[model samples]
Target: MTPPTGTPRPAQAAEAPARGSRLRKATALGLAAGLAATGIALSTEMTAGAAAQGSLPAGTQLYKDPNSQVVRWVAAHPGDSRQPIIARRIASQPQAVWFSNYSPSTVTNDVKAVTTAAAAGGQVPVLAVYEIPNRDCGGASAGGAPDLASYDAWVRNFAAGLGSGQSIVILEPDSIALTTCLSAQQQSDRFASLSRAGAAIHAAAPHAKVYMDGGHSAWNSAPEQASRLRTAGILTSADGLFTNVSNFNTTANEVNFAKNVLAALGNPGNLHAVVDTSRNGNGPAGGGAWCDPSGRAIGAYPTTNTGDPAIDAFLWVKPPGEADGCAGPAGTFLPDVAYALASAGASDPTTPPPTTAPPTTTPPTTAPPTTAPPTTAPPTTAPPTTAPPTGAACSVSYKIASAWSGGFTTDVTVRNTGSAAVNGWSLKWAFPGDQQITSAWNAKTTQSGANVTATDLGYNAAVPVGGSTGFGFQGTGSNTASPTAFTLNGTVCTVS
Candidate 1:
């Protein structure tokens, strides 16, 4: 999702992959759910070498040896504590998913929410701790615990939230790197609290993988950053290190720096590094504002395929498209930035980078076209539209996915509250006002002034026996409808 108009948070990618000719606009809705949107899954088990996502160049196999075996097994099966909170999993070198947001007070509930979805398989979800003391390190995205004592209590809750499920805890972001702004005693106190936080989480979820931030390769020297982690109990209690939590750094550079930090910390085996690939194609612009920073594209999403054994998955800890309140209010949704980031990931996940990850759900952008092209002679058989599914839980949902002037892209979500998925669907709407489609991309967007009908073609013609398909269009007019109706084949779901 794009950063809200003018905010500090990054702009997560959330749209469709590159179309041969027409690029279907994507809404930045799935950003909080980090896992790259599309890619081939790891199908083979490794003996001494491994193959990961395209984000990491092929031939760069993680050793299938002892240590890697454990990691590989963990990588092969991504466990989502809560699938609903985390909607999609991006299979990059280091496979990772982000949990959808939940209240800080209910930290454990959120953790359970994600792990429940994970079921098993050892899939690691990215978890962020914002209830820290002096969060944001007093920068653009600043919002932390009211005080150190409160923060310590919050950390304890956060640790308990793990709930036995495996997770990659991205400890209080910018907590250490940006601590200079604090007073001497305040810094020390915060560090001590951070140590306790790590201890608490490790105690609760031994299966979890906790990594302390290493800033970005560009921000701190390996030796310097490693020293901080070491002091923060990284070597003793935490798994290892994490880099680029909320910044831009290429896979190679981040890996290189992470390795250096590990070597410096002198705990390579115990310490593994992960990179944040929410928005880093172009890397840092000259100035570097951090939130929705421009010239950025898409970096690798959280994955476990780091070329080096010390590196972990490239997870998206930051919710893409959600503004980093700094630029505006810190946590508002922005559509344009969301579209840009989602589109970038669909095309280039290793470009502009960010630190975001959300829930898990199936992403079929790169799947075989569900609809047939228009070249065939079936005049009635128009191409399947690029409408996304929705309302699977709700009785009805209207998805106004994307837009560009005259026409806007759309989709629908239908809840199969009934015993079965609606097999056939037809969308009908009358013109309470004047709206017409000037041009259409993924749908056979046809209209009779206010009367608009959109239907899927080809394989999508019939929704799964228990599933639903969305019909979309690119139309023009004031989006005002006194009565917009929908019919699944012949059954009416929405009436005016």
Candidate 2:
């Protein structure tokens, strides 16, 4: 999922008059402290379920919609080297159907197609209703219905397609969280529209569950955000709020912040929330580096059984592999990034953990008798001419171009020290910790276990003696150390 274009502002100093706001502020502070201490604990609960049921949670009724861009990519590019990994890691997983376009003529039919299929399959489909006026504050993901009346008509058409089936509707991304840029009147109008949209969807499909947007934890203070949610009619218009859609905040932090927000709303009818755990395996990188930053890993697989009562489900709201504007055009699917996210070893059981063996004890051994041999004469014939070097002896240099909390971008240079040229080369290294490559350029890269291998692209394979070639990558981890060792064609290289 692409992050909103406008940057999140600091929390305003103006205090909310509601007593509930004061209580929520105090509770959120405590939860934030706990999140800081624990960080993100690796959980296998969701992974185990996905593996058993071919990527869907076992015994869960959430729909695994067959229509997704990644699924289509896999079908079209069967011969691409990255196809299998992308298919296994992302295409197989369930994600939301995003209706970003404003097509009044076909919107109803499009929504009906997905809901009808899922209903027949005895499952619930997730719909991301993103056509809000002035969406993303007229930034990158901008464009929605022209005005309030148009938006109301659009929502009506979209809801008509629900077909009385179970559906989870994500109202709009960045509509509430990024409202500081809007005027007071505009903000009020937007909130009213959201409330009406939720009511419209429910009227069409009584079984539908609508979750309004609540941005990520990093964007707004919990009390302020809770106040906004309450004003948006969260109590009567929707089931609950959803957080971290197309953002990188960790689940632990989002869960804590969400609970605080709900508590501030006085837990209206014991309302709960769902989290977008699409690409937050490593959590947010510091400094708001949101547009296609490198090093991000896919988070937990989508599952209805999220273990936490307040958290209804962990859904993949933003599909992996889609660029957030910088890597490619915004929303374009890049297979290289998809493969990197999949191979990052977050939930991959095929990646073996580092092992430790017991130390071995050696028995005593006697030294052989020292015997002095007679001197030998020089060889009669001259030594055969030394053979020419056959392969390149390469060395690699790594540098951190930029870094944030959970992710960083790096540049790697491969130099040939040998006398001969290398027609083809494969550079390999093993991460010292949980670091994983999320995106790469100038070369093709793959990962297994802690090891990463980058093969030269067709245009840059050959490296002449004393010449060099290079590639770049983005990965996730904090305080990442340089790779301990590097090898070229199985031969160890000197790291610098």
Which candidate comes out best when scored by lDDT?
2
Query: Judged by lDDT against the true structure, how good is candidate 2?
Result: 0.64
Overall lDDT per candidate, in order of appearance:
0.47, 0.64
lDDT of 2 by residue, 1-496 (tens): 3421111111100100000000011112112223223322222321121111011233467666565657777788766655766677677777777776667887898788888888898988887777778776655465678998899889889989988766888888777777645776677777777777776776677667788878778777777677777666666667888888877788899999898888877876546788988778878654455655445778988777778777778888777766564454456566665765675537742223223221132211111111100011112232222332466477888987666688776878888888787766778899988888865665566789789988754445567788787777768987588887998876678887
lDDT string for model 1 (293-395, tens) is 4334556654465555666666655544444432223434333334334434535344232234543443232212211111111126544333334433214
TM-score of each: 0.51, 0.64
Worst 10 residues of 2 by lDDT: 15-24
Runs with alpha carbons beyond 4 Å of true place in candidate 1: 1-105, 120-122, 326-328, 345-496
Residue pairs in candidate 2 whose N, alpha carbon or C atoms collide under 3 angstroms: 286-405, 295-474, 295-475, 295-476
Model 1 residue 105 CA deviation (Å) reads 4.8
